[model samples]
Target: MQRSLLLRCSNSIFRPPPNSHRLRPPSLKRQSAPIAASSGAQLPLTFSQNYRTAPNRLHCSVSESQWKQDREMATADEQQDPRIARISSAIRVIPDFPKPGIMFQDITTLLLDTKAFKDTIDLFVERYRDKNISVVAGVEARGFIFGPPIALAIGAKFVPMRKPNKLPGEVISEEYSLEYGTDKMEMHVGAVEAGEHALVIDDLIATGGTLCAAVKLLERVGVHVVECACVIELLGLKGRERLGDRPLFVLVNST
Candidate 1:
């Protein structure tokens, strides 16, 4: 059988292997363990377990109909938060453009729907508005879109982590390995003050090279990275494991 595609593209970004044909179930042995969000609400153990086992994953077998039902249920729960459903629906997927057999999650479609796009920003804004974050560091160039809006809403400064030589100022850079090759990300020196709390933003997390590089750059400068936030997480790639102990939050989990 031909492999399925999973594309992660926004300006310059990473892509996961094109083989996420099914959504894997979490292990059945553990008793319920609650994972708390910033709102003090408990998230399900399945979501918690999946989030905790980043860079590594657990898969289980189930009938096709049952898997379909599970996905439908997950979608229904996301719709309970109207904004999430809107955002997910607005994203478009393109196949075989950058290369054959690649399924790309295209945010450009989401950007076209003004209401959906605004709601996406509003949802993040509402969540982090009171989190006391001082700097919102966005990875170029999609993060450029999502970060500034959230920063402005929350009264925090927006910092851009750019590609090598993209920033003209005295900048610090970190080199990270990608599935294709190595890439370097740079941040302007003094853009953030020491001991400030920061939140890292990106459009997607695939193998997590870019997000990991962004976090490393921030920590090397003495900035505390409170969390990493993305619009989508390609769960099959297990990017979360590469991020160490920092909590990861996403609006959509695409398997």
Candidate 2:
């Protein structure tokens, strides 16, 4: 019975319902507010938020083409945030492990680096702390690594979304597709109360089927899914597109 449900869900992946919105990658909007560090915090010397070019300054005068070139260079430089670079560097990539031609983004390397792992959780905690999230629902396995810390830091309940039959009592499950087959994810029947706001956490999103199933399961139980968060995103697969209207946040994007 579970297998049949998963098969049906897998079929729906190819045929998205009409009127679904195309999911675009999240954009970082530059804030006009001046960047300021916390009290006693030392800012990175290489980058300065106070740096500005004025028309009156001798070095500020440039032709239109040069100005455009400078702007492009600045944009490129902005993409390499020091924190993100550290996090990305710690991830180990293994090629063709499960199969040929697949480059896996392994977070175990990040986990090994104590500083990097704490930073990973700290980043998520800082983002969600002020969002009033009542529950942090973590996807099975990898999500467990990141979820509890964030839940504890943000003062929210941690709910584990598990595989079929993993939960002891009555459970609600959602079937989703994988590259080879379909699988079902389950959550305890009373893990979350109706109208509670939740955030879903996962290590990465490849095709987004697991995250989608998670959202469906939570919503089915009347919990409001505020957003989905992941540590990394595989860009070429375009998994973000599969999640319609659901906001996704990730620390790193890799090919």
Candidate 3:
């Protein structure tokens, strides 16, 4: 049954019901608010507030009015961008997942859509392809999914920041705090050298702990982190603030 549902969803990737486009929430828009990065520059990218209700509820505490004004600011051009709508619609939101009161932004559905998955990598590649990035570091697990394609597309070497005991080599580690306890991320020794610029890629950002640890690990090895990028950002959690000055760039914002 689960497999059939996924297959149906995948098959309908490019076909939407008549006037379905009109029902899509506000299109993507560039954020006026600056997200600080290593260069102290602002990224001109889309930022939208996504609010989902019952059937596929979002466990967000914030009210919708607070973000309604921002949604209204979306430009006509942004609203017309097919990639934004396609990508946004492909994501599957699961309520009470992994525990109660949690809204998980599942990208497995998005991955099943060939065009959507390619667009995901294309967007990141278009942003970093000419930025002189030498290394692309991906956090364990999900990061392993989105990182390699972007790394390969941008002509950069892929570095995996793994969980403890996963890397079979001399490694360096950084311990980070989690909601329940603490965890550590390890990187192979000498994988990156001084004077190299890196971009950290992950699937999503909630509290930003994992990305922070990845940044710290790379910086500890004298690598200059260019910025951190993710496919989704849970605005309600304010994970962006946890990264300090390292800038964060994301494709979709959810609450």
lDDT of residue 243 for candidate 1: 71
Candidate 3, run of 10 with poorest lDDT: 1-10
What lDDT score belongs to each candidate, Candidate 1 first?
0.68, 0.64, 0.66
TM-score of each: 0.72, 0.69, 0.72
Clash counts for the predictions, in order: 4, 0, 2
Q: Against the correct fold, how does model 2 do in TM-score? A: 0.69
Q: Write the per-residue lDDT of candidate 3 for residues 1-255, one digit (tens) a residue.
A: 010000000000111112221112335332243332223444222222222221111222333453343333323323656676667667766533555334456789889889989988888888899989999999878889999999988899999999999999999999987655778989999999999999999988766778888999999989999888888765544556567657777766554
- Give me the runs in candidate 3 sitting further than 4 Å from their true place: 1-77
> What would the per-residue lDDT of candidate 2 be over residues 1-255, giving only the tens digit for each residue?
000000001111122122121222236222122212223332221101111111110111234565345334433533644566667667665433345334456678799888889888988888899998999999988999999999999999999999988889998889876645668999988899999999999998666777788999999989899889988765334466667667787776543
Clashing pairs in 2: none
Global CA lDDT computed for model 3: 0.66
Among residues 3 or more apart in sequence or in different chains, the pairs in candidate 1 whose N, CA or C atoms overlap within 3 Å are 7-103, 54-241, 55-238, 55-241
Best by lDDT: 1
Q: On residues 1-255, what C-alpha lDDT tens digit does candidate 1 reach at each position?
A: 111122112121223334443223333332334533324555333211111112233222335565455445556656467677677767655433355334466688788889989988887787788889999999988999999999999999999999998898999999987544678989998999889999999988765778989999999989999888888776556576567556777777665
Q: Following a full C-alpha superposition, what root-mean-square deviation does model 2 have from the true structure?
A: 16.8
User: Would you list the rank order by TM-score, best first?
Assistant: 1, 3, 2
True-structure lDDT of candidate 2 = 0.64
